[model samples]
Target: GYIVTHVDRATKYLMAQKIESKTAEAFNKATLSMFMPLAPSKRLTLTLDNGKEFSLFNKIENRLKIDIYFADPYCSWQRGTNENTNGLIRRYFPKKTDFSTITDNELQKVVHKINSRPRKSLDYQTPKEAFSLENMSGALGT
Candidate 1:
């Protein structure tokens, strides 16, 4: 399985889904499903990897009513929030963890745990708290 991870820049909120494949179609479906419930806001934007699997990004932008940008090659730091959140995820499932063997419920538990913690970036508010308080803005200085 492949892991698709998303982190809210404003709140450090995390959402992840495991897919059977890493194709563009799989990525698109997982992305839409994870975000559909919140529908978050039009202010949402994504900083993503330069991967062919994200070829359907334009479709996601249209459905979610948001913008998307690709990080520069070899510059993982460009997506700092995402990188940090990935580290947090690593705390639970270290490098080379067999994602295919991990169940979705087990993964959601990690996501829930990460979002419930307080962060200094959000002034000590939990990511879940800050996410609800966002009012559809201010993730990337909006």
Candidate 2:
């Protein structure tokens, strides 16, 4: 069992979901479900961790109609946003916490809190705000 996390590089918006297994089919299903609600334009590119669970990257690309790139192995900086997101998740559920015991409702609550919280990097605009197309132009990171 594993918890999958995805963070938007530009806005640092985070999406998290739990799967009962680490199998490729399970991984793909969880990942795709998360992106399904987002418009194709908002999810044009996905840079994923170099995990074997992502062996279905080709299928994901075809289904989402998006380019999929794998981050280089051993380089955390390449997926820094996701790494930071992992830490944020850990704050609520410590390292030894079991994903199986967590409920989808509980996970969604944490995701909501994180997205609604402001970040200095985004000029105090929450990721939810920065993620909206109308607020995409302004940036404190640059």
Candidate 3:
């Protein structure tokens, strides 16, 4: 099993869901389920790591009307926001933990805690707060 993580660049708002695999189809489905309800303008772009799981990036771009850019090979810093998100998740589940056994409710609890935690980057505002501000001000994009 695998888990897919998505972070809103401007807001630092994050979402993760456990999946049975990292196939393109699965990734697309998960992305849609997680983002479809949000205003399309809020999702202006996706900076993805170089991974086979994102082979279907076009589908996501087309479906969500968002640009998709890939990070340079071996350059994790390009996706620093996502790396930081992964660190937060690691604190809860750690490495080597079996995600297949984790329930949806359990995953949501962790997601909630992370979104509620304050961050210095946003002047100590929680991701949820930053996201709300972005939406309110129509500042989700560059």
Candidate 4:
């Protein structure tokens, strides 16, 4: 299982989903599909860790038409946004818990909570507020 989060840089909005999968290819497909409604453009650059779980990067790049960048091995700080998101997810799903027990609906609730929470980085704006469709669409047009 893997968790995916997409942040709209211009509006600072975040969309996250937890995927149930045993392989990297499945994760990539699920992530791409979830992000399609956002109208992804070349501005989408994914930065990921060098975990073996991300071996399907080529497939993801080809399918989504988005470039993927890898962080330096052993340097988690390079992907701080993801690292922070993983930490937040831990509140609901602690390490060592069986992910198979979590349902898609339960995972969606968790994603909602995270996106609705205010963040200091976004000037105390919830990701939902900062990255609402209205805000993002307006910014993209300008």
True lDDT of residue 39, candidate 3: 88
Q: Please give, for residues 1-33, the per-residue lDDT of candidate 4 as tens digits.
A: 666666555444556666676468666777677
Query: Pairs clashing in candidate 1?
Result: none
Ranking by TM-score: 3, 2, 1, 4
TM-score versus the correct structure, for each prediction: 0.89, 0.90, 0.95, 0.81
* lDDT, candidate 1, 26-137, per-residue tens: 9999999877776454346787899989999999989877788999999999998899888999999999998999999999999999999998888999998988777455
The predicted structure with the larger TM-score, 1 or 3, is: 3
In model 4, the runs with Cα more than 4 Å from the true position are: 5-14, 133-142
Off by over 4 Å in 1: 40-43, 136-142
Return whichever of 3 and 4 wins on lDDT: 3
Q: For candidate 2, what is the TM-score?
A: 0.90
Question: Mind giving the per-residue lDDT tens digits that candidate 3 earns over 109-134?
Answer: 99999999999989999999999988
Candidate 2 wrong stretches, greater than 4 Å: 134-142
lDDT of 4: 0.70
When summed lDDT is taken over every stretch of 10 residues in candidate 1, the lowest stretch is 133-142
Best by lDDT: 3
Error of 3 at 118 (Å): 1.1
Model 3, C-alpha of 37: deviation from truth (Å): 0.8
* Higher-ranked by lDDT: 1 or 4: 1
Candidate 2 residue-wise lDDT, 90-114, digit = tens: 8999998988999999999999999
